[model samples]
Target: MLQSTTGIERLVLVPSLLRSLLMYLQLQKRKDALACLKLWVCSGETLVVSLAKEFYNYFPENEYKLCNFYGSTEIMGDVTYHVITGMDQLRHQDKVPIGLPIDNTIIYILDSNYRPVKTGEIGELFAAGQNVAAGYVNGRDPEKFVENSLAIDPMFAKLYRTGDFAKLEKGTIFYEGRTDSQIKIRGHRVDLAEIEKAVTSIDGIGKAIVLCYQPGEINQALLAFVLTETNITEHQIEEALRQKLTSYMVPQVIILDSIPLLVNGKIDRQSLLKAYGNVNNNDISFQNGIDYKGVPKDQMHAAIALFETIASVLGKAARSTISIDANFYNIGGNSLNSIFTITALSDRGYHINISDFITAKDLGHILSKLSNDRKNAYLSGQTEHDYTSELLKDEYKEDVLDMITTSFYEKADLEQWLMPNIYVEDYRELIDAIWEPLVDKRLSLVVRAKNGEIHGVALNFDARDEPEVEIKSQLNIVFEFLESIEGPVRDNILPPGKGTVLHSFMMATRSTLTPGENVSIMNFMEDEVLKLAIERQFAGIFTTNTSPLTQQLGSDVYAYETIHDCQVNLYVASDNTKPFAKAPDSQRAKVQWKPV
Candidate 1:
């Protein structure tokens, strides 16, 4: 019926409703009805780039223009306008600009002191113009309407504070957010709109809304509701945010199929919060939401217990679904909360090390690591096999070399920086150079399966008696990097003796083993090494862990004391190049030791 209407040259609608209409028109094959619509004015909320791109795709003729109108009721409707003639304007923008003020309307970006902010600085928006409304009828919030401090003309005598933050660059005004959106998190002030902008800027995110749940209380948490068009998980979004924002600024991301909206087209934030509260308020309803399709009957009891513990900890902050395939981090588990989950599980007689839990690909893998008997059976796959740690042997050299080459090239974190510059020959050469000393030290250990295949290797050396070998390959870069972080601790922190400190130089597991299996084997090797250290009357065992799995085991599971920690990305080599420059700030090399 609306398709027959005439004289529809312009349309003013909220961005959200416009998006729904555009999608509907395209789906209904009614694009021709919009031929008379020459302009679309979007206001009431920020128009994200994703929505703008949708509009651009729907109307490619360039005959129609999209304008962003910015204003409040006190400003007598829109006081600023910007027109998008083509997609080029949105290519580099996160949000559509509110643009220059309308004729006879004056806009000022001012700081808390009411002074004009410099160009590109964000401040509260204030407006003074002929269209400015007189004081409110009830005379409430009288401070909002005040005498214009910078007014020179009689028409600009009244100024209305918009209570919104914005910045101006080259005469174009960009909306920042509302001032009331700021809240304190862990003693640091965080802007929900800033977090929302970051989340929306991610490549596949269609929309995002960041809200604080239970503010000013002990259970307060910052939550981000994201609508994504891709298969990206909550963990991936949170990791991406960690790269762009500080640790405290990162919010727990919840992926959603659709966001609730009000009749006026704006997001219904209160409904979103209420829904979260409802999900957490009822335990039976929450438990029913978990997926248990793939869980084994034998492990069902333990899985349910673990799930309940996790639910108790995460509560309202969990992602949309919980299942055997879901990752702990992807389901609202952070490092701190992970510890809480672990402690809760321990109380219920379920046990798994932090490294195993942190590195598990999914909850099913974590469930396998909860018990030693089950872990060994799970790692061996079809048939259970007895694995044992044995001292270094001459006949196992070939198998050891193969494991080292594959593990270092494919899984080692530090070697990844050198990339194409590293080769299998480098590791072969490294093994050859150190082979003699490794055997003589009698400190190296390897884990062998029932089939006599070596799956894990740990090469150790006395802190003061280790032999020095000349390395001629790019693998030397890894050694140099290790020495730069490990040398100081050996020279100053550890005990000064050839037999007093056993330095764990290199440890690697087969490339085919799952992360949980790798941790199990490594744990066995570490235990055997400590026994050997105790037999030799050494004061302690010293090691440097670069991989995140080993780092967690050393610190959290094995109770090793950390002596020195170095950020891998911050290390500059002798060539003055940061080989690990692409590494995340959280990546580190930990020098740790456990006393005998």
Candidate 2:
């Protein structure tokens, strides 16, 4: 339809990245239709890089130039502009940023402290420009429109907070996500915009809309509606998402023919919520409570068959309808039901790695890849590490106690604040008291070096069920410090509660010849702790002692929240879970029903 648009030289409008790419693709095929369209000016939402590539591929690079503009309704429009040439498009292949601020506009990316954030750090975007409106009609929103006291120029003292999260990279500002749209799932902070970016990055995916199944709750799950022509399963999409995002950040993919849009052409989020509001996303899997009788003889065939079954389940179609080349995503596969497919395959003794499945070209390709990986592992004589892992033995009890006490005493001078004398002695006593019980429950690991010397020891077990006077006192002191943290910090700390807490009593490492050996031992112990947590389904994990290695490990892998007080550093790994500090309920607007 757009192929006949003659003499349309400059396309200056707000067309979605997907829509624009489609038009360009159709026009490029005819060689007449978008030929006149040069200097494509786009603004409205941030453009995804994949969509930009389509434009560059379909249209002549020298002829057509893409411009990305950024602005808000309050700031009129087109405050900042970024000309996307071949170089700019290639440079920002992941995301096409909003570029620099306009000539007269003063922009600031400030954190919650209202201080400028480092480059690439996400912060609230503020704009102070001539186009910025003075105030609302009735009265200015104090939160949105604030006096820019930090401004160097006294003339531009007023700045409007856009409530949009953005990251500045080399003078270019990339939209992260909206502050109000960001939500917590499984205690992890999830940016819907980040998810949308990942979704649109997929080869066949056109657009994505991610939403929180439930807001402001622990059981909250993420749901994603994706528009794509490729046959992709939920699990396959999930596997891809897992590579880009954390486990909690991966949303349940739902294939939609088209996104529900309002009259204004914006996504109708309210209508979407109303439709899927009551559906329990956690139980959206198709393999839930299904009984299977037979397994395929060929391993490769079995893997492909599993994917086909998963596609059928998610797409609500018969297995015969699915083709070998069809991707799971195009066939109604979603992340919510991918787990079931994997589980079903695992049940049949075919252990397929999710990572391989995510990047597979097609169903047959995934099965062949899985088969090849297994053959390669077998042919290469690959085997698990021969490291000894066992419960704390009665004979080594004294040795274990001495190792921990000696390490603490030695490191006390350096970390006196963290390794207080009282806490050290308390830890020793606690370990001594629980040694026998822990041995009975098989809850400790003592690793030895190649020279037969004790290298490291880690004690991880659920200790929430029974709490003695000493333990209770220690917890009370920790809780007291948390309480002392008045204001925002207090709210961000993990709340005190009891729900299967795994305590790492003493993770001590003996002096090694090299720092690399020490790191290896530490990593091995961390793996053990993670295994225990996964096996026992621990809601939270804690380390009584803190070291540089453990602290970095916590922040890097498990998202541990550290509490610094009482001359002791307690590290809590609750999936970096923090309660949202909400405004006072009384301050919210209220509407009362009056008699008609």
- Best-fitting candidate, measured by lDDT? 1
TM-score of 1: 0.52
**Backbone atom clashes (below 3 Å) for every candidate:** 0, 15
Q: lDDT (0-100) at residue 7 of candidate 2?
A: 61
Error of 2 at 273 (Å): 2.9
For 172-225, candidate 2 gives per-residue lDDT tens digits of: 888778877755432233578878878777777777888875453212347778
Per-model TM values vs. the true structure: 0.52, 0.51
| Least accurate 10 contiguous residues by lDDT in model 1 | 376-385
* Total colliding residue pairs, candidate 1: 0
In model 1, state the lDDT of residue 404: 86
lDDT of each: 0.80, 0.58
